[model samples]
Target: MSALLGCGIVLLAGCGSMPVTGDVKAVDASQPGDSQVQVYAVAPREGAAPSEVVDGFLESMTSDDPDFRTTRKYLTEEAARTWKPSEGTTVLAKAPNRNGPSLHDKERRSTETSYRLTGEKVAAVDEESSYQPLAPTDYSQTLHLVRGNGADGKGEWRIDIVPDGLVLGQSDFKRLYRSVNKYYFASGRTNGQSALVADPVYVRNRTDPVTRMDTATQTVRTLLAGPTNWLRPVVDSRFPTGTALRKGVTSLAPDDQNVLKVPLNQKADKAGQGACRMMAAQVLFTLRDLTSARVEQVELESDRGRLCSLGADEAEEFASDNGSGAPDSQYFIDDKGRVLRIPGNTRGSGDPEPVTGPLGTGTVVMSAVGVARDEQHAAAVSANHQNLYVASMVADGELAGPAVTSRAKKAEDRLSRPSWDGRGDLWVADRDPDSRRLLRLANGEGKPQEVTVPSLDGGRIEEVRMSADGVRIALLLSKDGLMTLKIGRIERHGPESAPKVSVEDLRQAAPQLTDVTALSWSGRSRLVVVGKEDGGVQQVRYVQADGSTSSSGVLPGVNQVQAVAAADDELLPLMAETVDDGIVKLSPGDNWQTVLKGGMSLVYPG
Candidate 1:
């Protein structure tokens, strides 16, 4: 017998109680345990009772069984044949509790036995492997079992009807799956140049039960499948519709020279050389950080012949603005209200210098500043926080009149710190109580336009930050003395000459944080959030755009953080403004160190 089966039998033997009579007791197989421990499923013993069968199956779902064949053993022939485990996954707060073996027919003694499976649903992973966090709610499902004859010529109990997909505890789900990013081209290109956007999804950490593919292969299949529903409106997949991996290919690995060769189906052969190259680029980006061995190149092929290939260097054409082409300089407002910059590649407490612009020259005192991704222009909020000014950083020049101004009676309700998107547009929130709105300025010079947020739901916009891809925006909203962080999709409709922009489908990005003080986009699908949980101290942590938490998300504690900033290039140090430390930076594997003795509103180019 295999070691898996051996381990399973040992576990089953330890159950201690036998079910002989018609009285079937509920079995709770999901107990909290070490997440790193591997679990294996045991097949039903001959003449096993219904409770044993159900318990075995539920435990099997949490195991790393390659094809889930052991789990199927607990089901009837019809149920086994029809069950689709790949439909989706439901993650609960803990192992689902088995409620009762209630009689399916109370009037008479029936062969059918039923049990209620209940738990607190915390999240769901759809068929596309996109995870969405759900407000905690009660979850209930039913399992029907029938007595039948086993292949061993003995009476046995098997599941006749079962819930679709897999139900797993949060810890088990985390142990079995990991998040991976699939690359797609942004729908709207700037200056006629395309940039790749990341669409993150979960994949099995080991071999998948449904497809029997390794993690890398499963990720590739998901990429070719297409983007998730939330991101589909703003991104385009390079793979042709119906395109898929060559049938029967289950595993993929880089060659000795770190070249990954992907064989697609016949549909991919229709792509022209340029389109084929783009497809290869998508693959290269998706797999670049997936494997231990660096994938230096990607070659696409069909049964007919080689379609196209892309190398790590050649794929730079599709690189996003956040890519590692150049380091981003960090900026902050000094105690004197002048904008100062730290060189991008500087190490440990580099000297801060004033930028070559009016705001930096003290010509116009500022309280906050946002540098454009190109580092050529900056938007600054007046020291009084009522007016926003945009000026060139490449050369000293007279500052233009306020590009945007607020009329609120109080300084705190006037204007928010400005932010620049990858497309050179500026975004800021007008917190005026009488006229709360999110405003955007085209090219940072045009008149500010109020962007509609249909889902604001009476909440006031406190601050605004734009993603580098221009398809998403992060907002800090205040309502009823509570603050929340939300991520909204930026949808551009109508014609390019006069487009209608609306921030829609706002989802909670940091549901754990009761009061979010500040946040910044840290990577393609991650953010550095500074906030406090209910009745907890202030914390700085990393959170995925999808709102899922990781074991390593929490960072070293920083006191009284007023604002936080991170670069798309994660290697750069993280900067924060604090009440006691002034401007401080935390480099990789190091503690927070003071960068400036007295500074505020620290930021990196968006």
Candidate 2:
């Protein structure tokens, strides 16, 4: 008898449990050891046939033991010692084909072997405890079994050899796996301010045999792999491309003082001292979240010598380096398309005040507007969407430049909401059917400059928002008949007078979300998302940059949300436009507060 145990990625949703297919009676193969031990202890049935032995072995695979020592009872002595369950686990959509394990007689020998352990592999878990969603595929393994003498000297079936690790159904995987947050930094922040951006991903729980350091190593590897496709451009990693731990090293080794000694390749050694310290900061923040031990410091080493060492306290100095911090006031376009502002965290009923500009007079019907981080500038789109205007935020502030319009023929196909980066550069996406691209108005004025965004695949950008630190952008995109939330990093090259701007590493932030209507960054690495699930009602929720949700369920008080805005506090001074077009505000534990009767579009400074 041969058994194949393997795992793959891509598990389908809603596949709950595997029902028993045939009349194979469920056997209560209990163990003789202390029942209190937290291990899978199923004793082999005496005088049992090969098929019954295979059934008991499969049942033992589901136990949540720290080690598979008890599970080894179903195997021969040699096979028990040779089996390494931690190699990897294969999660299946359904239980294996138990009836297919064929037993073959040996020629004058007390041994028989079985063949064919097969199922649909959906997801996989590695020895490091990381979970990867994979494409659905069929998997088959062969198990070798032997007919041996039992403790009572009777004939018994025992598995002599099997593929590494265990195979489980989707239900077992859901019960065993957990999601955790890994931290990375935003790429472009002015003045060296850095903030932590959480990348949520799946991993094995503490009960798994994987140690804390091994789990930490998996998290580090993911971080080194860079942000997921959607978050890649919006965030930055301290470890440069091609920089990784020394070969043959699986986990980080920390000293008695909790100082993690990380050995990197030559690429890391070339990074200067300042760069090395920032790299250490990323490691410190990530490890702190994974291990209970105080990761007080990180010592980065290269083949040549010590590259740099960073103390935990030094991270605070670069708090905004990731472009996470943003302006706190909530700005919006009112019923008449006039620009207005409201105190972000106010409790009492507050009237929206018009800002200082032609936009406030309603002379120009404004469709959208973006407030700059300094609160001194504003980018406005006309009600027709044909023309874009930029001016000062002060009272009667003069126009910064002449009206700007794209070459597109239709108004709706023209510019999107205008956004401002830390350097005061204005950005807008032109969704013209004939010519789709992102245009920038340097310092919120002057002629339009085209910014290259790779792999957009001709999808129209519905809306774009720049981060406060000026290094990243969040996008609402309509591509291939689906609305997606994507993030990317902004790279500038050449002289300061005529810089070249390109958006690269574009990736989807919410791949499972089918109908994303509105999204805005609430923290350095967090966003308040409003969307609908497949065939579900419209809802609001919070998600990490890596596309994992930190909040439970959707935000309450509305059948559908039209627009959403966020500020960077824990309680999250969240505001949204309801299906009825009324504006509402949400606090951490409070119901939606309808602050205004009617509103157009709203935004918080990037």
Candidate 3:
């Protein structure tokens, strides 16, 4: 790292006299005021005095010695004279410096000190402490710039010296260097500390300590971006650190809201209009918790680097020519873009899906499933890229509930399964998208109620799914937060001895629960609930999908995590999402971590 530090660096000059105004404030012996005034200006380049001004200023900042020292003398005819303190000025760099003049990293670059000048009115001029570096890159020193007896007397402006970070980001860095170059040549580009005040009058004399900043910029740029950097970087290295600097996070909602996701087809087909062309992955419209609609043509192949539309709107007419022999697995979202209701997949814009369902960054995983489009729950069984999967709700690899959508005509025997029970269970309801609707399956010899959700856009019924307990069913409705045959329902409350095994019973049991926000069943007996408290952060809790939590520690860490959702025992064991270059794992053990640097780790959930 020492090799990164340059040797020709000069120290502060022009201390005994004022660098600017040509007249350093004398300790006025016959004064009416209480203090003195001191002013420092920009230094000049090498060779000539004006050129050394900037160097002098820098030297003052870097030097252990005072860049300028003047005595406050008092003597009036030897009879009685007075000298008092007034205003004192100081400068500082606001933020901590991540990089300094030298570092081991080859990519590191050096930056000049930025100064924040301020003043204070005092009774007397006092010596100030030496300046200190805020971090590795910044330095700050405060001094009472003046001491005077005037009506206006107090610390004045608070200024900051802009550091390399802001300076480098500016687009005109190169041009500024050129203007300073001309000033340097006339000064003979000497190698000594001096001053150069830009204040108009001092323009003629190169001897004056202060001058223009244009000279320093040119010299520095030449040394840094020039051939000299090849042999030994003329620029100083940045500060050293245990880790690299980082940027803040941006909301995922904003990312999806602005970016439109569409599916593209390469091969031409004669099946339908715009059949093989990359049609707009139409944004499905939904009334939040109500109905949904759109005209998107998406498929499970979305997981294969494509974004599949779950809405009936987009895929309504997306029929592939049967003569071409399209596979049974290939299907599209209706003309609408919708998905299983996942907790955060609220399509406030009427297109209900994950705030992140576009699918092209390749950051999503097989675990990167699109959530169902519901306010209470989020669900997606497959992706464009994930391998085929079987759900506890989906037995025998067959979707026994809602029939899959197709572009071709339907057959007479569309196929059917017994409702909840072996007999004809019949309590099926596909009304609301955000609520629960039960489909009754008889225990014995009875006909089960059929499940038929209406087309959200007044178009057609698309898809549906049932809860594992076989009590609740989910339907894909239109974008409106309402529905006709609303599936949203409260589980019936039963007696305490024979408690009703439904959500309503459990919710009714809570004396203070008010309402439930996050609801999920842990197997059959336990249920998890997460909701915000009136006065505190959100509460992470659970009871029975059908039972109330009366026990202590129901919600251990309130607000410990944001965006909590139900992750069954099955989804927690492996890596769930890959973001950037890191993997976010959802451990069933109730823990998570990310990979970065040599690896990465997320904030721990205590």
Candidate 4:
């Protein structure tokens, strides 16, 4: 595994084989076409003093150019050619502190002054375009300014020394950069259906006139370049190794009919019709966020002829197989260890009923349980947390097979709540210090197969929840003694042979949050996270699958949140377990109503 350290977060990009082989077009420079043009802007205004020069340069780093060449004007001739903007970037929550114009040398009147920028670093992106969650910490950077003779022979400030990367405030960073997800194939299949995993990255937003089309071009270019450093290992892209738009074709704007024409080299023409469709699907999904409703189809063209075309309506067919609808019922585990169900639309009027199976008979003791997406199968952890059991939910059905034992020597370091994926696979983490691993059970029965997770270093997984799409997994982990929530991509290799599953590309969804106790998938692209920051009360908040918080307010009336669950129904019903073990339902307006008492391990189907 290869790793890139960011703040306190370490991103892992494991090595894996791309199972499918297909021809993809490479960018051809000889081809004639209308591509986006690049425009340069004037540099920052000249400053008279060292501090002013340093401040102006720092502010210019957030300019609208895809490259920081405009900002480079602040650097001296030597520094301009040596500076590397792609080295890495440090994202800060606020503007950096300006420390001093201290003299570089004490003898005589020093001609050089050094100014230091200090602030709280929130995240970092490496040269490979991998974004890592960073623990908030003081970050300091220094740039030396030299007094030099100007055009008129008067002294002017010029930055002679500085770091390679850029730094900007969180608000400015968010405004200037847009987050877009690239689609890749999941490790496993559901009902013989292939799934698409989402890999998100930040790009310059579409606010600049000179680089207005850069967003689409960069998004497509990055997708063709493959998943970011952290996700490169497990996931596979349909685009061939050399696949890309023709060299001069940077602007990929859609025509009047909302159709995008992506001309490629002849290699892409060799791809089979099916493979071509898959390639188009990847492009369609990645551009979906940027184009929104304007994009209706994508046509792949080569120097020879049109390879294939994919319509927005059929994108899901060739891309993700997560399904088109949501579940109609909410699910939970009662204090007595029975699986309970609540009609989503009925919210406050109905009494919860035990699921029809041995789980409802009160004969078994379960500490945690997960219902499959179909709601017909379930995997449960014993009250002791050392054993795992699988059972059917039919009326009067009994648990199947003996309980699976844990490898942990201590009882507390046992199995966590199991999660079911769209493929009907049950996943759980065994926290046994002696044999820490993630286990996947097929069809909720028998011994589990061990799956590889991102290099945790010393971190431990506390909970795991698979998205309804089975393309992502939400994890609450404890690293460096701090509880944090992260998202990891699931990659399955050699599907026809001995298929193997590995989790890689771990990134923070709520980097600003700590003491995350529990989390659950609330919607196709959203999660309900239960966590609190230092000196703050435990509360429930909604977050995107990528780890960004949603504007949806936190759940009310809870000092401590223990667990949460969301039904797939259109209304997106939600349930939470409080400190007292009472289950509360979140109303449409963020209102909370006690629905049941003595409820724990609340969960929805995979």
Candidate 5:
């Protein structure tokens, strides 16, 4: 009668874990105490596994005593019942012991072996450790994992693990790593080996492991050898996945490591909207390569009911690399917290150019950098801000975007920000040297509408705007410091004819000192003007066309202002203000409201 005693591996050739599909069951048929493993000397180990290994590593963090029984003959085996032995038995199925002498490897590795006193079927496995780092974080080190049978089987090797430190921070990864630290065969379904899609084109069996994209020829190469599959680059260069932090990421690799700066997924469909998405995601999981979670571990969990989707940490694989990269993986998600696959990500069949629908490109365009935001639909000036711009961000009191239109200048570049005019015409604002011009990109004559507001140097344009009725245009004027608001019935004036309103007494300066700056059209005749009070006390006043005004009271502490717009109606009535690059929304409340968050613009186009 043949009884299964224990099991373990001799590791004649293969380097780590069970074959991609082979059996890694820790089942050895050997008897108690006499089992031993024999590995041929193909190389010597340069790095040692660790002292006390698993239990010791975890025990330090807990109150329980965690010491392994060195003399017990219980081998970690299969068909036996459990993974960790029953706590008391020498029916001894032993895992391969990492004593000394191994292949040269810098990757953190653990070898688990299982075998009995007399057996042939050995179960063994080898695993590499992972890490994590804080954003703008960059760290690199060479780790050596040495393992063998007796006291002399040691080998040396090198492996690169970026984001290697991430695993170090996660309690889950550490738990998972130690649960099966000492490598054994078949980590079971949930615990089994995971395959990572290391590069952009590695999707089929026709290719091996180390696949390469030739920078020289722009061609791709695949590495083929024993057990063959390598994704090595022809010149070994990489492109950044998003916005590249030139100075920040330099520390991640040797000065020689090529910092990848691939054409941003949609570099400038409209977000920061010109250059590209930073090589690193400002949120989480910026870098996209093996150093991070590799393809298999970066899943974008979509939230179906919500506008934005949630992404899997360093665990789930991304479905594709189209519109949303990084954690914006979810086109949408279901209520169960599971990722609901979106349309473009067709089961990841590898579609390169997913068509861009009406939503502009799903690229990071202009992120609100100021402390101003509007209620879901706040009506903005309907003009692209160009006068105050360093970048398309509200740095001081300015906002900006790169020049993308035909009138673009290296300096005063003009990007077309087309806001519709209830009519089929597109409206755009251009800030020329002395002209605050508004253009109709499409006109009644089938040409772009170009309306330039004559310079305020002659007389300041306290406020210039199109009425909600779409029938008239109102240009509030405060020639000097006093407010001399004016109204114009633009539809009757024709496009080329400029509307001018003058109140002789209104143009004259006054000692009252109303330094009006921001204007909100509350109604065709009523307006909200924010300015200094009698003693420079900041206040927002509601002014009626009849020249009578109501006090909205002092604006509290905030003084700096760029743009302010009111929401359309009562139900969705909203207000937005640009503080810096951040847009803050003024939630309706008592007299005045303090800024509660960063920002997102909500323009009520209707």
Candidate 6:
């Protein structure tokens, strides 16, 4: 690796008054087109000053060196042996500013010097590879250097005490790592069916420094490791306890036939054929977006031999209805306050037709609507926004009386838009000041049950959108004139006869947006949000469920966006209701075009 650094190198003298008495050059931090363009670590020259050693170590932390052997070269033997880069990662807004090398023990003329590293922390990645974006906060740490004996028999400055794990700038972190989703089954499935839930995590884009594995291999290993801490409460992994990849296996690739063969340890050898196939499904779903070569099949192997195999087509049995299968038809309320639909896969403002229901026939005026994942049932909020009604979309019939009603005097404080989960349950938020609560109806019909949200912290839920997977929910919370988007884990407890649902651990999913107006789940781990920064113009963009932002998140500018809707299938055009343009749709690679000149409240089935 050091030899590779010698080629295409640019060397410059160290600057500043920190006593950097060695060759220092700027690291190539440009965003590359692919993982092939990587920055390798340069070994510390002999007798490097304290500042140079500290700078070199920080630079090496961002490199693609497989094991960080070069990173340890700047540390003393004790520090090197004690350092653990895999413990966690601290991401900063920019490279940390170094100050000092002030003499300690001035009275005794000690050889030790200390440097203060400070920066603004932006996010953190735990050992489990879970990324959590945090409110920017001040970060401070100290690196102590001491004189040590060198192989040349001269005094050398090396880091003696350092912080555990890697500390990287946000730009470098993004360049070195990529987000990937691991699959797990939703727990407590009373029926004979199973659904895979996505657990997104970050991993090295190239080879992992600590694991010494390629991207695909690392992702599979993480899948076997189980779900993340926040998601573990509601999901289960098919992999048995202690199951792991076969020892000494560091790379995984698809054959010419696009089949990936994964060898597992003895723990998996005992799994039955059914369990083995489920395990294969988890791997296939997790790696679907990672590998350069498409994987058509997954064959699981054990110490003894092949245990079982699953083809890509067969893996659909475990697919989650949330974003799987065909594209969903877009729905909205027309100018006449009746529900209308745009057929799925239609392009350029295709003919809009009325749905086959009372809500569509104007039997009862409607303001908002949510269609079930199956497209069999639809829930509509009355024009007054005080009454909630559920009607069949397949069978034409008169709508029954209000299934759920809100008594808030002001229309703005009435019921919110309805959302249906993949489990065939309907969810809505009652914004009534005196009776503020989230309600859910089993099968879109029984008595409305109040879903507990214990972590609201005096804030009110302005809107609610349930992920199709049924294990997560997106909430728009309003407090002090600001609306923030938060993602909460949906936990179901007790027995199937009487289940208790609660939305817990509410965390900011779009902290960068000062005020969020509307949002919808666009993919497994992504959301299309219509919001803006402080004092900035209203705009549309995509946000990961984890709250991290990417350069490509921002969409082409749309004017006066009052509402936004995105389908789980990303191929469908993004629909939104704007003041300037009544309703507009943005296709995959095209600009926004008017869909309906008079429609409002556009949305896709949740």
Best by TM-score: 6
Worst ten in a row by lDDT for model 4: 11-20
- Per-candidate local distance difference test: 0.83, 0.68, 0.23, 0.70, 0.26, 0.84
Quote model 3's TM-score. Answer: 0.21
Candidate 1 lDDT by residue in tens digits, 172-276: 788788888898988866467677888889999768887889899999999999999999999898788999999999899999999999999999988999888
User: Which of the predicted structures, 3 or 6, would earn the higher lDDT when compared with the native?
Assistant: 6
Of 2 and 4, the candidate ranking higher by lDDT: 4
For each candidate in turn, the TM-score is: 0.93, 0.70, 0.21, 0.80, 0.29, 0.94
**Candidate 5 at 544: error in angstroms?**
2.2
Clashes of each: 0, 33, 150, 2, 121, 0
Error of 3 at 497 (Å): 32
State which candidate has the highest lDDT.
Answer: 6
Model 6 Cα lDDT, one tens digit per residue, 447-540: 9989999889888998899887789999999999999999999999999656998999998875768899999988677889999888999889
Better of 3 and 6 by TM-score: 6
Residue lDDT tens for model 4, 175-276: 556667877765434355666667777676654323344688878877888887666665678777788787677577789899998988766766888888
Report the CA-based lDDT of candidate 4 relative to the real structure: 0.70
RMSD for each of the candidates:
3.5, 8.1, 29.5, 11.5, 29.2, 3.2
Candidate 3 lDDT, tens digit per residue, 308-343? Answer: 324345332221111112110111111122222212
- Please identify model 3 stretches exceeding 4 Å from their true place: 1-511, 550-606
Q: For candidate 2, what is the lDDT? A: 0.68
Residue 385, model 2: lDDT of: 88
Candidate 5 ranges with C-alpha deviation above 4 Å: 1-364, 367-426, 434-436, 441-446, 452-464, 475-486, 493-513, 533-535, 552-559, 578-596, 600-602
How far off is residue 234 in model 2, in Å? 8.5
